[model samples]
Target: MRNYSGVGNTLTLTAPYDVASGGGALIGATFGVSKLALKAGQRGPFEVTGAYDLPKDNAAVAEGVRAYWDNANKVVTATANGNTPVGVFTAARSAGAATANVRLNGSF
Candidate 1:
């Protein structure tokens, strides 16, 4: 255990842009939920793992399907094209819904 570190569920990252608490942020290639509001260039904790209610596009999503992070739009999506894989949809989401439930996979 000499090289052990703390659990990585929450990690520190400099915000690339102003982000509110519970907002999704992508730093470099890592994506996670901000633990607190952070101004651009401020370093703070981000929860990289766990289920979350994330904003989504006007697209219906079926339960149990993989979810992707639409970084350009800052929303969770079912489309994989040009999007980063964040996790899976935990529940069905109808088109036009404001958000979708997702379980973070903790890795890009």
Candidate 2:
């Protein structure tokens, strides 16, 4: 799925459009709501980044995603470059719009 929003909070499992007999899925990803906090007198802003690869295009993937580090059966290695840093979400942040700069924020 490229980009999708839920109606209310729901737990739904989405299946890939294509899965080979034994090839399985090539890529899989997921996202969820999360919370963050900022102490008093915090500066402009900070960045929260995950260790993963950014999708090269905005296709069926690259929606609400980072990479899913799945080492199926411990066969495929997903953390070979786990130390590599990906881009951070540093924009769309509310500009000083919190009593204590603490709240739950994330995309669906």
Candidate 3:
């Protein structure tokens, strides 16, 4: 393997609004987690792809299940129809857990 530019799996983009580190960000339909806290219009690294631990809905989720993003509540749910899907749940999440591991599928 040859290492050229040395760019990792993350991308830098201007924050559309204030976002905390690890918070979800939607850039032109590309959903990702903010690598660092950023103010509105500030350029920062964002993880556009890969598995990430993110906040999940109260509903219990099983491993290998597809999860949808609830834009209004900013959480991932097991429901599919009418919701924006963000990724597949790689780990089972009990209703008590606040977050779940998700393998991001990226821009549908």
Candidate 4:
């Protein structure tokens, strides 16, 4: 295949802010999990397609529900009003839980 690049399982994204490894990042419309801790403005590997446990608000979330990235709070959220759609919750989580399992949709 001409002009083909390697599989885009991971992308190098510049941290918009300090982000810990496994944390979600949304750059414009692209969202992915950091492969390692990164300081603001640093560029690093971000896994774009995979299941990850990410921090979320204290709200009950059902499996198969779409997950949005709250860039302001840096958490996975069910709210879509002012957030970036990142992926889907692969596991239901009860209210008060600190995290939710999300499967990155890659194409989103």
For each of the candidates, give the backbone clash count.
0, 0, 0, 0
Per-residue lDDT of candidate 2, residues 48-79 (tens digit): 22222222212222222232322232111212
Worst 10 residues of 1 by lDDT: 99-108
Please tell me which model should have the higher TM-score, number 2 or number 4: 4
The candidate maximizing TM-score is 1
lDDT of 3 at 27: 63
**CA lDDT scores, all candidates in order:** 0.94, 0.24, 0.82, 0.91
Off by over 4 Å in 2: 1-12, 19-49, 58-106
For candidate 1, report its TM-score. 0.96
Structural similarity to truth (TM-score) of each candidate: 0.96, 0.16, 0.80, 0.95
Give a tens-digit lDDT track for model 4, residues 1-108. Answer: 898877999999898888898888887689989999999999999999989999999889999999999998899988889998888999899999999999998998
lDDT of candidate 1 over 79-99, digit per residue (tens): 999998999999998999999
Candidate 3 CA-lDDT value: 0.82
List clashing residue pairs in candidate 4. Answer: none
Q: How far is candidate 3 from the true structure (C-alpha RMSD, Å)?
A: 3.2
- Kindly provide the TM-score of model 3 when superposed on the true structure, using C-alpha atoms: 0.80
Rank by TM-score (best first): 1, 4, 3, 2
Residue pairs with colliding backbones in model 1 are: none
- What TM-score does candidate 2 get on C-alpha atoms? 0.16
